[model samples]
Target: MKTAGGDAAAKRRAGERAAEEVEDGTVVGLGTGSTAAYAIEAIGDAVADGLEIRAIPTSFQSRQLALEVGIPLTTLDAVDRVDLAIDGADQVVDDPDATAHGTLIKGGGAAHSREKLVDAAADRFVVVADPSKLTARLDRSVPLEVLPDARTVAADRARVLGGEPTLRAAERKDGPVVTDNGNLVLDCDFGAIESPADLARDLSAIPGVLEHGLFVGLADATYVGTDDGVEIRAY
Candidate 1:
C-alpha cells in the first residue's frame, strides 16, 4: 500500500508536468481536486516567473487556490476560448479506440458539473493522476450532481439504469453534501462499466441530473505519476 506522502509526491509529479503545457497569453481552465491543486500551484509559480496567462477556475476551491498563488482570474463569459485545461480524475482507464488517452471518472469533489464545462471548452484538456487512479476499467462510483428537489427522482431513474445510487453524505455536517451550485450528489455504482459513453448518455438523459462523472472523449492527454517518474500519454 502506498503511503499518503508517496501518493502526494506522485500527484505533484503529474500535476507539475501538466502545468508545463500552459503557454503565455493563454486562458487556462483550472480544474479542482487534490492532484489538480498541484498543477494550479505550478502554474502560479510559472506566473510569478513572468508566464503571462489568465485562468477560469472550475470551482470555488480552485478559484481560491489560484488567488492564493497569485494567478490572475477571468470568467468564462469574458473569454472567447480556453487554450488548455488541466484536471485530475478519480479513476482513469485506457481505451485503445479513442482519440484521447482514455475515459475518466471524476467528481469526487462534487464539482463535475463545472469541471466538465471548463474542460470541454478548452482547446486541449489534460488529466493528471497518480498511479493509484489508473485502472483497467472504470469501476469507481460515478458522481452525479442533481437538483435538490429532484434528488429522489433522479436516484430512482439511476436505479432504473442498473446503478445503485447513494446520496453522498457530509463528513462533518448533518445533512447530505451540497455542491457549490446548490445541488445534491448521487454516487451511482455500476460495478465495472463496459461502455462509458452509453452510461454517460443514459445518465445525462435523466431529469435533474446536472452532470455525471464519466468524462468521455474529453481528454487530449494524460500524465500519470509513478514511483519511477511521470509517464506522458497523448491521444
Candidate 2:
C-alpha cells in the first residue's frame, strides 16, 4: 500500500515493466484507463526507439493515445490475434480458490466491453496495477454492457443474482452514459462476490448482456506495483 502519489508512481512502474514484454513485429492489444495509459506511453516510447509493432486499441481513448504516442495502429477487423495485451484491473484476486481466480471488475471508463474483446483475442493478457488494487475477495462493482432495449431486464437479472445494478450516469452530459458500442452499462455490486465465475456465467447467459467485467481465468500474468518494487505473478 502507498500514498496516492506513491500509487501513481507504482502504476507507472508497473506499466513500464509490462511494456518490456512487447517484442518487435508483434501485434499488441492496447487497453484503456489511467494505469493502462502508462503502458501506451511506454509503448509509444519504444516505437520512437525503433520497436516495430502494430497495436489494436480497446477504446477510443486508447486509440487516440496510441496515435499521439506514435504507436502503429490496426483494427480487430484487420488482425486475428494479439501477441500480448496490457491492461488495468479495478480489482484483482490472486487466490485460485477465490471466486474470481484472476477475475477483474473494470469499466470505470466505460470501455470494459471492448477491453474484454481485445483481451480475449490476445495470446497473453497482463494486468498492471498498484498493490492496493489487489484483494482477497472482490468488493468492487461489476460493469455489464447491456442492450439499450433490455436495460430493465438486465437490472432484473442482476437483482436475481444478488446484485444491486444501477445505470451509470454520465458526469459530463445529460442522461445515462453510453458505451462506445452504443449500449448502456450496469454497474452491479454483489457484496464480496462469493463466486465470481458462477456469476460471470450467469451474466453471460442473459440475452441482453453483451459483456461483463468478470475476467475469469483470462489473465496470464499480473505486474503489481508495491512499495518494495514491482512484483510479477504468473498464473
Candidate 3:
C-alpha cells in the first residue's frame, strides 16, 4: 500500500504493512512526516495484533504516535541498538508518486532532527514513500537544522556549497512557525546533490550545527511505494 499524497486511510494501511514486516522483539526506529504517520499507525495495529517491537521515535510527534499505536516504546538512550528503521520520505526521484511507495522529500514535518539519530543507531533504515518523490538525484530541496544563533552562518555555508538557503517560516497560532523539534527550519535549494554523503559530512563538521535533513550513510535501503508496489534501492 502506498501512502504518499494519499488520504489518511491509505497512509494508515501502508504504515500498517510496513510495521507488520518487523520481527518481534526488534528495536525499530520510527520516522516522522505524513507518510510516517501511516507507519506509526501500522506499528500500533501490529501491536494490536500481538507483535511486540520496541519503537524509538525520531521526534516528539513520533513518540506520541508510538503511544497512540500501542507499540511498546523506548528512547534511544534507553535502548542499545535498532534492528530496523521503518519510516517515510517526502520525495523519491526514481518513480511516480502514489500512496504505497516512491522517492521522498522528508523532514518537512520536522522529524529530520531525530530521524538521523535513529538511522545512525539502526542496522537498517528502510525508507517508505510514494513514487512522486523519486528523482534523478538527491538534494533538490534540502532541509537544514542549525543552532538558533548560527542559522545565518549555516545558511552562508550552504550558499557556499551552491545552495540558496531560505529561513523556514510559518504562521503560528500566535506568532512564529514551530518546527517539530520546537526549532526553526531552513530550506536550501542545492538543485541536484551529486554527492549527498560528502556534503552531509561537511555540514556535520561545521560548528553550531545541530543536524541537517540529509541522510547519508544512515540509509541502508530505500523502499518506494508506487501505484504498483514498493521498489527497493540500495548502494
User: Model 2, which residues run further than 4 Å from truth?
Assistant: 1-6, 96-99
Q: What order do you get sorting by lDDT, best first?
A: 1, 2, 3
Q: How does model 3 score by TM-score?
A: 0.84
Q: Identify the leading candidate in terms of lDDT.
A: 1
In model 1, where do residues sit more than 4 Å from their true spots? 1-6, 95-101
lDDT of 3 by residue, 7-67 (tens): 5454454555576668888999988877677778777877898887788888887788778
| Candidate 1: tens digits of C-alpha lDDT, residues 1-235 | 1223339889989999999999999999999988899999999999999999999999999999999999999999999999999999998886565432378999999999999999999999999999888777889999999999999999999999889999999999899999999999999999988889899999999999999999998998889988878998777
Tens-digit lDDT string for candidate 2 (1-235): 1223338888988988999999999999999877888899999999999999999999998999999999999988898679999999888997766545677888888899999989998999999998888888888899999999999999998999899999999999999999999999999999998888888899999889999998888899889877767899888
**Candidate 1 lDDT for residue 14:** 93
Cα lDDT for residue 177, candidate 3: 49
Worst 10 residues of 3 by lDDT: 95-104
